[model samples]
Target: MEWHQPPAALVRTMNVVLRGVLPSPLGRGVGEFMLLAFTGRRTGQRYRVPVTAHRVAGDLCALTPAGWRLNFRGGADVDVTLAGRTTPMRGVLVEDRAEVARIYLDRMTELGMRRAARMIGLKFPLGRLPALDEVAELARREHFGVVRLSVRT
Candidate 1:
């Protein structure tokens, strides 16, 4: 898929809005959105991006089509702010397409067919989720990455 970069102004606006809202109760009610804080691998500067996160078997999972996930390629620690609370977590970049597919499929299944359909811009039969193999094939074609985070209690 061709990547289209958003305008810098739009990105600036989103960063401002997310920074202001993410720490509020309103942001917590806005579904699985979370603020991911990680250090840039090259610059050693902190960066925060808003991502949709899922709780899978006691771990936080995020699927991204962006390059920001590459920051964790060196197994760096991160901070995730969800529901107005921040926690330290260790992040792993799952490069195996099959494993990424499995986790992505599970998250889509938990989101249910209708919502998942809207998310991927596909139409699906009611109550039916895509098969794991199908997801794997799509992931391979689309180059999706999975970031699995374990919260340090």
Candidate 2:
């Protein structure tokens, strides 16, 4: 399924709202969002990006298809700020389409299909669970995946 981007103004507005709330005392109220701070590998530039994340198993995973995710291609150190606390973590990008599809399906199953679809830009008929093959095709076409973030030990 093809995805559509929200209006640029709406995107900007959400960025503003997320930037304010995701680091505040009420951060967790918004659910599944955090601020990720990382330095670029080649340019050494710093970046703070807001991402939707869900805890899977014992780690936080952020689904993304943005270019900035390349920074974690091989795994990189990062600082995750959530609910007014900052912690160092390692982020590894999982770009394999099949694996990404599995994780996405698992999350949808866990989070409820409608809610997950709204958050992840997925579209499908109501009450019908999408097959893994369908999801894998979407992942392949979209180049979308998750970044698995774990506390640095």
Which regions of candidate 1 fall more than 4 Å away from where they truly are? 1-15, 118-128
The TM-scores, one per candidate, come to: 0.78, 0.89
Query: Best TM-score goes to which candidate?
Result: 2
Q: Model 1, poorest ten-residue lDDT window?
A: 118-127
**lDDT tens digits by residue: candidate 2, 1-153:** 344456779878888888888878878676667899999999999988888778777778888767888899999999998877888999999867788889988877787767777677666664666788977887777878789999999
Residue pairs with clashing backbones, model 2: none
Superposition TM-score, candidate 2 onto the true structure: 0.89
| lDDT for model 1 | 0.75
lDDT of 1 by residue, 42-140 (tens): 899898888766777777777777788888785778888888878899888987787888887877777776665544333454346778887787777
User: Which residue pairs show collisions in model 1?
Assistant: none
